[model samples]
Target: MGKIPTTIPRRQLGRRLRDMRQEAGISIQDAARLIERGAGTLQRLEKGEANRIRMLDIQALCQIYDRMDELPGLLELAKVAASKDGEQGLWWNEYSDAIRDDFELYVRLEASASKLTVYQSEIIPGLVQTADYARTLGARYFSDTSSREIEQVVTVRLNRQRIITRRRNPVEVDLLLDENALRRVVGGPKVMAAALRRLADLPANVTIRVLPFSAGFPLGVACGPFVVLDFDRATGEPPTVYVEGYRGNLYYDRAEAVAQYRDTFRTLQAVASSPADSKQMLRRLAREYER
Candidate 1:
């Protein structure tokens, strides 16, 4: 069996192929019939879940859809999709054992996201967590996890931070952290101090705002912690909201749901401290932790 292509580009390409087929007024069954493959196979191809895709199959589909002009781009997408050795992309695949399978999709989306708006009430955002802070949380939460596995978890998180600092196209991160999150010591006073320092020294692309506990019951209070990831508009990938649960993570991409999260974020931003004030508050809190 051929290795499945799971990169974001491949998924985007598959989605584009599906859109083209639909625009040509072709049904999945008809397209599958044209290519002599099962309807499920064609469906998966369009959804980017297929373990493998053939350039010839893509060409045939394009021809059937009368979209010969799209052949070059689709073929190029096929080549890139087929280039993956296995599930490896952006380095997250290496720590698959420590991370949940379902969450990998979120990581993949995050890797390619152009912007991330994160609101956390209890802990530091993963993308910005320091190594000691991450290690402490990992050990506490995954009580049964081995030391090596915990380290691997930390490595994956620290590696993820690169997306924000990358030389080209750094992901813009907008974070609204509840005041309690900073006050709550994670690793210890020293660890908490270091983590706060890290957050304080974030690059220009990363924005942080602290929502004080004094600002009682903002719009996002009931919403809990969630992240909205926005991709490039050209890719046809809509903004996504991620909500984590005890059992699994839930993703919302529908326009209405996505809109609600976006609006809520804006409201929260209004109530949160300005960036300058937030940074000053972080410094003050760090000093408190030092004592």
Candidate 2:
């Protein structure tokens, strides 16, 4: 029918719909029957993978979920989700073939995040990484990946960085990095040095903290690299935790899971060097790399 929605808003609407259904104690099969759609179709809608969503279907589902009070906002979100594709398509959609579906979802959330709290144990966080640094790491780990594909990945990484630097209401970034991240030479000393210097030059809205080896593996050590994205409360979007692994990414929106990650982040912030101290550390590391 109309241009099927394929952006982040659609996915978010689906997630909200799913949450409403569960809160109403309705099963997927029951909900599907009420909407006169097959179980698979209903599942797709709830998962945000549906190409098209009829406004009438959304109204009916909201009624079934007894969420009439939220109808106005839900309708608005649906309309935005179904609008012309390219007009509002996410920037990362172009690199869809190069990244996993879960990563695509993560990119969507990252775009809308009002604030980002990240703890990176390995290399520099993507939000602050330089192009050379990103390409170096990508080429090393994904040696089998074609040069063109690696470039696409690097391009996407650079675009993601813009989220924090955009002029209008740039997302506030709080980064907690492990000391080892600074010492490891990702793209040789020159690239590593440049990256470290770049961190030192971040805008006032960005905060970087280095968790020294002396910190001795806090609770977050086992968690690996995870990001906690907080959205505008007015949007009714709950805080979310995104954990990345070798295979794919895992998303956690459940209150307990989100809280655990938040707590870990706070703890890490305490143990890591203060922002001022971290910047100085970065400068020193850059000099070391230069030498």
Q: What lDDT would candidate 1 get against the real structure? A: 0.84
Number of clashes in every candidate structure?
Answer: 0, 0
- Point to the candidate with the largest lDDT: 1
Which window of ten consecutive residues has the lowest lDDT sum in model 2?
1-10
lDDT of 2 by residue, 209-255 (tens): 99998898677335598999988775566888889999877878889
State in Å the error of residue 152, model 2.
1.7
lDDT of 1 by residue, 1-291 (tens): 122325566677777888888899989998999899999999878766677888899899888988999899888878877776545544776788877776777777887788999998888988999999999999998899899999998998998888898787888999999988898888889999999989999999999999998888876346588999988786567788999877888878778999998888898888899999999999998998999
Q: What are the clashing pairs of model 2?
A: none
lDDT of 1 at 182: 96
Report the C-alpha displacement of residue 206, candidate 1, in angstroms.
Answer: 0.7
Off by over 4 Å in 1: 1-6, 13-82, 85-89
